[model samples]
Target: MRIALIGRPNCGKSTLFNQVAGYKAETGNFHGTTVTYTESKVRVLGEVVDLVDLPGTYVLGGSNPAEKVSHDYLGDHPVDVIINVIDATFLAQSLELTLELLRLDKPVLLAMNMMDEVARLGIKLDGPALEKELGVRIVPVVASKGRGIKALFLEAKRAAEQGILQPRFDDFQDDPYSRHKAALQLSQRFAVQGQRTLSWRDRLDDIFLHPAYGYVALAGVLLLFFQAVYGVGQLIEPPLLALFDSLITNLNTYIDTGNLLGVLLNGVLQGVMAGFAIVLPYLFPFLLGLGFLEDVGYLPRIAFLMDSLMHRIGLHGKAIVPFILGYGCNVPAIMSTRTLEDSRERFIAAALSTLVPCAARLVVVFGLVAFYLGPLYAFGLYLLNLFIIALTGRILTRLLPENTPGMILEMPPYRIPTLRAVANKAWFRIREFIVEAWPTLIFGSAALGLLVFFDIAKYFNWMVRPITWLLDLPAEVGVPLIFGVLRKELSLIMLGQALGNNDYSAVLSNAQLFTFTVFVVFFVPCVATLVMLKRELGSRQMVWVTLITIIIAMGAGLAARIFGLLL
Candidate 1:
């Protein structure tokens, strides 16, 4: 049996998925679609069944990959039943989406989640009445607490065997406005409002979502977040790197360091050191903090805070999701452009999203600027990054004009983050680096070492000399810049090989370090991101984006060099 899970974001869809997703659960792109969904094999009703979790979206009919997946899967796949997860706190909007599912004429088991929060809000929902009204089974569940999940799946299994039930109300029509009104009427009739007591969660939003204090608080939160990452990275990185350097010096005693075999061996070692010492030190803690913020439901509030500012770039607040994801990795950030309805907005969001300083670029900034200079210098680089991104957005928007609609989002209530969930999320990302990126870094580092030993690297250095000259950086940096396009971490790792020194501060001045880091941060994204841009946009736009990035990097690097000189 195949049972699908569907719901809007912040409705506990992910919580429920985690509850039931066995180790077999994995996320992948749907066949013939670019966006992804998760599927798992689970035993339900004494039989192993396929449980699929679709992407979270507010409306299924909207113009996004979610719509295409919904229409394609529901229309063709053997989807026996759908478990529509609903947030009881936002019944009106949740039910409005349920109405969309009913139009499919498929069996739906309504899972009303977050009942605990509902009760605390003093909102009463008549389960039986709503079930009767909608002609579906309604199961009250608190997914995070593991309440009612067993019975919920049991009902889902039963519904799959029973087949489809016709929607009870004829008020459901083709029009969206009609569906909205009907959902509102049904919630009013079935739910009763009680004496509400204000809680800390309510007041928390008042501060987090406040106009004046919110930005101040955001700055404070970010400052602490970066400090924590830098602190942990600082303490661990020095001892580890020193150990590796000592081992390399000892290895030189066994054989000549200039020989071909010795150079290749050392190159591979540097790659491993880069991933373990320089990258993971900063990457893990950054991801941990990001996951905590995400689980605590603070990310969307940032979008709300930045919505007005986002409009200055020809995008809506919803477009900020890609930017947030970009900080983690640019591949997923590009993938997230599907959530934006307008093509122009998607392009603009994707373009700016790449500039958000991903974890790879994060390592570069933290390793060189933050580590050698200070956190304040690294912080200055980030400020410069955002300013450049905003300036680029302003330019792009003027070229392709559009008026984006204001954001309408359901704010999930703040909940204490679970260690298991946050850690697992961070682990998944770190594991991806271990499995996919680490190998590339090791092999690329080795290849770069061979090129430098053979004197062929000078050609690559020659190719990028114009940009290096313009930025007032060392000519040898051109080779690392060329190879860095394959993987951003290579920019720094190979720089050590090209200059014949592992210690950057000993070789390069403060101005050179500042300028080079700026260039790497804004230069062409990694090959993965480039492929994703091509997949998302088109070949033509991909070329345009790549070219535009090279130009931007040159401009930003030169600007940083001039600033360094003036200071």
Candidate 2:
């Protein structure tokens, strides 16, 4: 038997999927984490059953990729039952989505997830009445803690066996606003009895959603996030670098021998594995923190709060999703532009995503700028990217056809997302990065080794002299740029080895190093992103992204050089 788990984003659908599917497949707190549907098989009651986790969506009709996946599956795929997970804390808004599912004329069992928080808020759910009214089984569950999950699955499995569970009430039409109102009134009557108690969460929301303080808080949050990334990298990088050095020493002395062994150890293994040590330790921890914040449902609030500013740039608030994803890796972020509706919006979003200093870029920036200029310069680079993104977004908005839609987003109530869930999600994304970029990184190292072997690097360095001259960088920085086109992290790794120190002062001036780092920041994304851009937005847009980025990087580097001279 086949069963599908569906719900609006951040409604614990993926959490329940992890629970039932017995592994982390599609789980996150952010929008569009599960852009594609994931299918798995599980054993229940000694019988193996197929389970599919569909992407979360407010409605099946929405144009976003996640919504399309869910909508298409409902229309075509034959599912014995639907497990509609809803956030118990945000019942009014979540139930509106539930109403839409009810209208789909399929068997749905409502799993009122996060019930622990609901009960703590002193909210009483009339589960039997709600089930009777909806003509479906209502199973109150806390997906994170595994509370009431067994009952939910038991009911879900029974529903699957018995066929459809249709709703009793069919009074409301399918309009978003109408269903929103109806769901609200229904919740007001059944969920929140008497006066809804003033919980700490409500008070916190008031502070966070405040117009003046909220914006300040958001800025502070972003600033701290970048600073934390730098601070954490400092705490970890030295020891890890030393460890790799020791390992490389032992491997060269004892392990490496024959031509094949020598090539694999010194050229392929040492270079690529060294690259992973430099990048992943910093990238994974930072990404894990971001993933925690995402799973806690803060990213959508950021999108909502930034919507007005985003609209000025031809993007809805939802663009923040792709932008945050960009920090992890640009390839997925570029593909994620499908969440944005308009063609112009996707183009603008894709371009901005490329500018966002991804984790790999951050590794480069931290290693180069932080070592050369200071941590302050590294922090400034992040802010500089943000400023450029916002400014360029506005420019592209005005330059384009002006059909970008405003952001209509849902702000899920804050909850303590499970560590396992967050780790699983962070792992999935980081794993994708390792799998896709690591091979290219290894090949880049081998190619560089070959270049050095043939003494071609010297001539190639001379060939790119014009670019180095314009950017106020040494000819040697060009080597990293060559490897950088393949993988951004390699730029820093190459720079470290070339400089023969983590400090990087031997190869270039402080001003020149900072300029070069900024240039790398705005440089064209790695080949992975370029390929994805071609696939997502077509070859024309891909060419435009490449040309625009090169121009921007050069301009920024020149400006930085002039500013340094004045300083």
Any runs in candidate 2 off by more than 4 Å, and if so which? 22-33, 90-106, 165-194, 246-264, 458-463, 496-503, 564-567
Tens digits of lDDT, candidate 1, 1-567: 888888765576656877887322222111111245677887765788888777666677656765566556666778889999998888988988898888777788899998988899899989998888888899999987779999999999888877865546557676788888999999999988888998888899889888899999988998899899999889888998998889878877886658999888878888998898889988999999987877787767787888889888778777777787789899888887886667888899998988889999999998888878888999999999989998999999899877676566555567877787777778878889999999999999999888988989889888988888888888999888988899999999988888888889998988999999999999999999999999999999899898889889989988889888965
Please give the TM-score that candidate 1 achieves against the real structure: 0.92
Considering every candidate listed, which one attains the maximal lDDT? 1
The sequence of per-residue lDDT tens digits that candidate 2 reaches over residues 1-567 is: 888888887777777888777655655566677777888888877778888888878877877665788989988888888888888877887888788887776678898898877777777888888778778889988888788878877888898877774535676987998998889988887786435677676677676778998889888887888777777777887787778777776887875434554644565754666565677767877887888877777888888788888887778889888898888788878877887777788899999999999888888887777856788888887878888888888778778878655666666667676787778778877777778777777777666666665557878788778888887777876787877888898887666544445457776777887788888889889988999999888999999999989988888888889866864
Give the lowest summed-lDDT range of ten residues in model 2: 256-265
In terms of TM-score, the best-performing candidate is 1
The C-alpha local distance difference test score for the whole of candidate 1 amounts to 0.83
Give the number of colliding residue pairs in candidate 2.
0
All candidates' lDDT scores?
A: 0.83, 0.79
Pairs that collide in candidate 1 are: none
